[model samples]
Target: MNVIETAIAGLLILEPTAYGDDRGFFLESWNRRRFADFGLDLEFVQDNHSRSAAGVLRGLHFQDPNPQGKLVRVVNGRAWDVAVDIRAGSATFGKWVGVELSATNKRMFWVPDGFAHGFLALEDDTDFLYKCTSYFEPANEHSLQWNDPILGIDWPLDGLEPQLSGRDRVGMPFAAIATVA
Candidate 1:
C-alpha cells in the first residue's frame, strides 16, 4: 500500500497495490509491518461498518477522553470523506482535507487521534468500513458543525440537502468547544 500524507498533520491517504489476473484481483488491505514502516503504529482494536444513501452526511465527530484513530475505506459505492484537525496547539488546527473513496478507486484514509472524522455519501447504498484504535465512548463524543462558517468546508452539495442526525444537526461551532491538548 502507498501511504500519502495530507496537508493536515497526521492524516494519510492509503492506496493499496492491486494485482489482477484473469481469475480476479488480490490486494493486502492491512498489514501491521507495512503500516509500521509507514510510521503508523496503531493497533486497531475495533472495526465498524455503516451504510448510507446519497445526500446522507455523518460526521465531524470525535471523542475527547478516548479519541479514536481511524483507518477508513469505502467497501461499496462512493463517498466524499473528510478529516478535520482539532488538536489544540497544532499548526494546522481547524483545517481539513477531503478525498473521494469508492470501490473502484479502493482508496483509504487514516485519521489519527485528535481529529474529527466524517463523510458524505455520493452514491446510494454506500458502505463505509473503518478500523479504530480505541473503542467508542459515547460520554466523550462531540460533534462540530459540518457547515460552520468559520471552517468553510467546500462540500460538493450539488443542490441536494444533506440528511443529518439530530446530534449532527445540533453540533457546536468550533469557537464553542474547549479543546485542550
Candidate 2:
C-alpha cells in the first residue's frame, strides 16, 4: 500500500497494491501492522456503509465529545469526498481537502480526529464505506454548513444541482458552533 499525505496535517490517502488475474482481484483493505507502519494507528471500532444517488450530498458532520477518525472509500460508484480541519488550535483550521473516490481507483482517505467529513455522490448509485475510530453519539453530533462562505469550499457543481437532506440543508455555519478542544 502507498500512503500519501495531503495538504492538511494528519490526513492521508492510501493506494493499495492490487493483485489481479483473469477471474478477479485481491487486495488487503485493512491490515493493522501495515497501517501502523505507515503511521496510522487508528483502532477502528465501527464500520458503516451508505448508498446514495447522483447529486446527493451528505455531511460536514462530526461528533463533538468523541470525534471519529475515519478511513473512507467508495465501493460501487464515485463521489467527491471532503474533509475539513476543525481543531481549535490547528494552523489549518477551517481549511478543507477533497478527492475523487471511485471503485476503479480503490483509494482510501484517512480523516483523523478533529475534522468534519462529507461526500457528494457523482454517479447514479454510489456505495460508500468507512471505518470509524469511535462509535457514534447522536447527542454530540454536529454539522457544519457545506456551503459556508467563510470556508469557501469549491464544490464541483459542474452545472448540476446538489440534493441535500433536511438535516444537512439546515446545518449551522461554523462560526455559530462552539467548537471545543
Candidate 3:
C-alpha cells in the first residue's frame, strides 16, 4: 500500500496494490499488522456502509467528546470526499482537503479524530464504506454546514444541486462550531 499524506496532520490517502487476473482483482483493504507498519496501529470498533444517489451529500459531521477516526472509501461508483480540520488550536484549523474516491481508483481516505468529514456522491448508487475507531454516539454528533462560507469547500457540483438530510440542512455554521470543537 502507498500512503499519501495530506496538508493537514493525521489525514492520509492509502492506495493498495491490486493484483488482477482474467477474472477479477484482489487487494487487501485493511490488515492490522500491515497498517501498523505505517504507524497506523488503530483499533476499529464500528463499520458502516451507506449508499447514496448522485448529488446526495452526507456529513461535514463529527463527534465532539467521542471523536471517531475513520478509514473511508468508495466500493462502487464515485464520490468527492472531504475532510476539514476542526481540531481546536491546530495549525490547519478551518482548512480542508478533498479527494475523488472511486471504485476504479480503489483508494482509501483516513480522517483522524477531531476533524469533520463528508462526501458528495458523484455517480448513481455510490457505495461508501468506512471503519471507525470509536462507536458512534448520536447525541455527540454534530454537522458543520456542508456549504459553510467560512470553510469554502470546493465541491464538484457542476450543474447539480446537492440533496441533504434535515440534519445537514440545519447544521451549525463553521464559526459557531469553533466554540464547541
Candidate 4:
C-alpha cells in the first residue's frame, strides 16, 4: 500500500498495490501489519456501506465524545469525498480536503478523528464503504453545514442540486460548532 498524506495533518490517501493477470486482479484492502508499518495501527470496529444516487449528499458529520476515524473507499461508481479539520487550535482548522474516489482508482481515504466527513455521489448508484475506528454514537453525532461559506467546500455540483437530509440541511455553521478541547 502506498500511503500519502493529505494537506491536513493526519489525513491520508492510500493506494493499495494491485496484482493483475489476464483473468483478474487482487489487492488487500486492509492489512493490520502493513498499516502498522506506516504508523497506522488503527483498530476498525465497524464497517458501513451505502448506495447513493447522483446528487445525494450525506454528511459533514462527526461524533463529539466518541469520535470516529474513517477509512473510506468507493466500491462502485464515483464520488467526491471531503474532510474538514475541526480540531480546535490546529493550524488547518476550518480547512478541508477533497478528492475523487472511484472504483477504477481504488484509492482509500483516511479521515481521522477531529474532522467532519461527507461525500457527493457523482454517478447514479454509487456504492460507498467505510471502516470506522470507533462505534457510532448517534447521541454524540453532529453535522456541519456542507455549504457553509466560511468553510468553503467546493462540492462538484455543476448541473444538479445537492440532495440533503433534514438533519444535514439544518447542520450548524462553522461559528456555531463548539470547539473541542
Candidate 5:
C-alpha cells in the first residue's frame, strides 16, 4: 500500500497494490502492522456501507463529542469524496481536501476525527464503504453545510444539482460553528 499525505494534517490517500490475473484481482485492504508502520494507528470499531445514485450527496457531517476517523473507499462505481478540517484551533481549520475514489483505481481515503466528511456519487449507482474508528451516536452527529460559501467546496456536479437529505439541506453554516480562533 502506498500512503500519500494531503495538505491537511492527518488526511491520507492510500493506493493499494492490486495483483490481477485472468479471473480478477486481489489486494490487501487492511493490515494492522503495515498501517502502524506508516504511523496510522486507528482502531476501527464499525464498518458502514451506503449506495447512492449519481446526484446524491451525503454529508459534510461529523460526530462532535465522538468524532470518527474514517477509512473510505468505493467498492463499485465512483465517487468524489471530501473532508474538511473543523478542529477548533488547528492550523488548517475550515480548509478541505477532495479526492476521486473509484473501483478501478481502488484508492482509499483516510479522514481523521477532527474533520467533517461527505461524498458525491459520480456514477449512477455507487457503493461507498468505510471503517469508522468510533461507533456512531446519532445524537452527537452534526452537519456542516455542503455548499457553505466560507468553505467554498468545488463539487464536480457535472451540470446536475446535488440531491441532499433534509438534514444536509439545513446544515449549520461554517461561520456559525463555534470554535476558538
Candidate 6:
C-alpha cells in the first residue's frame, strides 16, 4: 500500500497495490502487520457500510467521549470524502482535506479521531464502507454543520442540493461544537 499524508498530522490517503488480470483483481484492504509498519497500529472494533444515492450527504459527524478513527473507502461508485480537524490547540484546527474515492481508484482515507468526517455521493448506489477504531456512542455523537461558512468545506454539489438527514440538517456550527482534545 502507498500511503499519502495530508496536511493534517495524522490524516492519510492509502492506495493499495492491486493485482489484476482478465479474470479479476485482488487487493488487501487491511493487514495488521503492514499497517503497523506504517505506524498505524489500529484495532478496529466495528465495521459499517452505507449505500447512498447521488446528492446524499451523510455527515460531518464525530463522537466526543468515545472518538473513532475511521478507515473509509468507496466500493461501488464515487464520492467526495472530507475530514476537518477539530483537535483543540492544534495548528490545523478548522482545516480540512477532501479526496475522491471510488471503485476505480481503490483509495482509502484514514480519518483519525479528533476530526469531523463526511462524504458526498457523486453517483447513484455509492457504497461507503469503513472500519472504526472505537464502538459508536450515539449519546456522544456530534455533528458539525456541513455548510458552515467558517469551515468553508467546498462540497462538489454542482447545482444539486444535498439531501441531509434530520440530525445533519440541525448540525452545530463550528463555533458551537466542543473541540476534541
lDDT of each: 0.91, 0.91, 0.95, 0.93, 0.94, 0.95
Tell me each candidate's TM-score.
Answer: 0.96, 0.96, 0.98, 0.96, 0.97, 0.97
lDDT of 6 at 3: 97
CA RMSD, predictions in order = 1.3, 1.3, 0.8, 1.2, 1.0, 1.2
lDDT of 5 by residue, 102-157 (tens): 99999999998899999999997899999999999999999989999999999999
> Higher-TM-score candidate among 1 and 6?
6
Estimate, for each residue in 1-181, the C-alpha lDDT of model 3 and write its tens digit.
9999998879999999999999999999999999999999999999999999999999899998989999999999999999999988899999999999999999999999989999999999999999999999999999989999999999999977899999999999999977754
The C-alpha stretches of model 1 lying farther than 4 A from their native spots are 178-181
lDDT comparison, 2 vs 4, better candidate: 4
Which pairs in model 5 have colliding backbones?
Answer: none
What tens-digit string does per-residue lDDT give for candidate 4 at 1-181? 8888888889999999999999878999999999989988999999999999999999999999899999999989999999999888889988999999999999999999999999999999999999999999999999999999999899999967899999999998888864533
In model 1, residue pairs whose N, Cα or C atoms come closer than 3 Å (at least 3 residues apart or on different chains), thus clashing, are none
Q: What is the lDDT of residue 156 in candidate 3?
A: 94
RMSD of 4: 1.2
- lDDT per residue for candidate 1 within 110-151, as digits (tens), equals 999989889999999999999999999899999999998888
What is the C-alpha local distance difference test score of candidate 4?
Answer: 0.93
* Candidate 3: residue 45 Cα off by (Å): 0.6
By TM-score, is 2 or 3 better? 3
- lDDT per residue (tens digit) for residues 1-181 in model 2: 9988999989888999899999978988999989999788769899999999999999999888989999999999999999999888889988999999999999999999999999999997899999999999999898889999988887887988799988899988888753543
Q: Pick out the ten consecutive residues of candidate 2 with the lowest summed lDDT.
A: 172-181
Model 4 TM-score, all chains together: 0.96
| Candidate 2 Cα outliers beyond 4 Å, as residue runs | 178-181
- Shift in Å, residue 116, candidate 4: 0.2
Clashes of each: 0, 0, 0, 0, 0, 0
Stronger candidate by lDDT (1 vs 4) = 4
